[model samples]
Target: MLFFLPDAAAAVRAYARLLRPGGRLVLSTFTEVTDADKEWFQHLGAALGPYLPASPEPAPGSPPPPEARLRTQQSLADVLTDGGFSDLRFAEIAHRTVFARPEQFWDWLWSAGMRGMMESIAPQDHDAVRTALTALVAERLRAADGTLGWTTSIRFTTARRP
Candidate 1:
């Protein structure tokens, strides 16, 4: 969830302060996204570009996005060390999700975090977005065995407050 924070450094500092001396802090963040996932997001962005509001540009000299700020092991360690943590440990885990069909994948999107973006589309445009997304999924995600799979990389970090 660190990737979702607007100020991850401040959040990490607060976590450090909240823990007792020698206490452990463990957290997870997405480290990488599969090519399939990248294509999925790209298709969604293109399909929703006309309906969604334009994202605001960052102010001059502002910090990078949270995901980029702690994207690698070194960056994650740096943030924790800056927050006065030590004895850091890191692990990377990968997971793959498979859906039986395009409709199943569509349902999973509505049932998961992507629901928020889907909800933002006007009611009148839901069918259009659905049609566009489903077509893309069938073309790009379908496998010979008739399943769609996406893989993601996650990092789990453990640090000690000292």
Candidate 2:
């Protein structure tokens, strides 16, 4: 099942309450936000000036979110154990999702997490944002064939309820 739990330990404890003894729980989440992702947000912030305080990417040296902490094998295992889970296992899934056209990328940006930011942008600035975003995306992700590529790193964590 997909979970948006931000507190790894709380997530583990909650899962433990739901699962019967010896039941298994498997979940996947991102471990880190790459520099390219930060760049994308930075570009977006620039386009929507004064609308956003900062990029979505957490500031450097700040405490990482729970998902980031769970990226560490030891941290995940420890949390699971403390929450009554045993036999924890982890695996990494790396992949690239390509948008065949810029429109597809824009569609995803609007439909996915970036939707919230869209509401904050003034209607008049939409075109400008799009134009700037297109250039930014083209600079970083445009491929020889014209598709835009996004690489993702996901961690799949599996554990058995003790």
Candidate 3:
């Protein structure tokens, strides 16, 4: 949720003020994805260009995305400490999901954050997009055993207000 905030520092400071001394805050943010995942999304973006909404470019000198700002432990620590936090700790949790079929992968996409993008497609075009997505996944992500797998990483940060 912090990653979606327009001003993460402000939110962090507010949290610190709201907490009693020695109170702790635990938050999770996404880490960078694997190269394979990046490639997959590139392909997905290209394939869905016609149906998906266009993303506007950020203005020059704008603050970096919250995820990018806190992608690493050092950067996250800096933010927390600046917000009056101490005893910062970080951990990463990784998950690998394997779908036995391309249709399963398509279903997983709809079940997750990608649902927003999926919903952007006209109801009439859902089948077409699903067909194209399944074909794309089958061609690029399917393994010899015929399963599609993707690994995702999330960073959990714990900080104490002091």
Candidate 4:
């Protein structure tokens, strides 16, 4: 929702207006995909079918979301500044989550964009995709304790209204 704003700067200004003077605004978001995670997903997609797309295409006449553009420190700072927020600060956080069972990972995947991909596949192909992904995670991404671990980059931003 942070992205695809008609005027992201103006939206920021509107957010600033909602806060009392000297109030602080804090926002956190997933920023970039780690290379390992990207590669893992690529492998999963390849195994799924003819390379299932990560996200669906935008509707006709819809503007593309600024997912990559606003991910950097500079871009976030610029937005806060344009919104008239002061004392801006930024932080990058490394986050990790582990799933003890392969089914847990599968459940997590189906909760989001991957659900669409899974539904698009034929019934026969579904089992093969699931088996391949499960094995891939266990073999390549799982920890010694039989848990699958994943890391991602997150950005935390704070700014104060002047």
- lDDT tens string, model 2, 73-129? 676778789988888788888878797766566667788656876777777777777
Candidate with the larger TM-score of 3 and 4: 3
Which predicted model would earn the best lDDT? 3
Candidate 1 on 52-162: residue-level lDDT in tens?
A: 766799999987865566778888898899988999999998877787766666678789767776677788987777777677778877668777866668789999999
Clashing residue pairs, backbone N/CA/C < 3 A, model 4: none
Q: Candidate 2 has which clashing residue pairs, if any?
A: none
Instruction: Choose the strongest candidate by TM-score.
Output: 3
Off by over 4 Å in 4: 4-6, 49-66, 113-119, 122-124, 144-146
TM-score of 1: 0.82
lDDT of each: 0.79, 0.73, 0.83, 0.75
Q: Candidates sorted by TM-score, descending order?
A: 3, 1, 4, 2
Screening candidate 1 with a backbone cut-off below 3 angstroms (N, C-alpha, C), the clashing residue pairs are none
Q: Model 2 misses residue 139 by how many Å?
A: 1.6
For each candidate in turn, give its C-alpha RMSD to the true structure in angstroms: 2.5, 3.9, 2.3, 3.4
lDDT of candidate 3 over 1-162, digit per residue (tens):
887788888999999999999999998988766687789879988878887777789999998865466677777787789999999888898877898878887789889877877887888888888888888888887667766876688899999997
Between the candidate structures 1 and 4, which one is better when assessed by TM-score? 1
The whole-model C-alpha lDDT of candidate 3 against the native structure comes to: 0.83
Candidate 4 per-residue C-alpha lDDT over 1-162 given as tens digits, one digit per residue, 9 for 90 to 100 = 565567778888998999999999888766766688678778776767553545677799775465555777777888889889989887888877787866566777778545766777677666676777778777777767666877677788889999
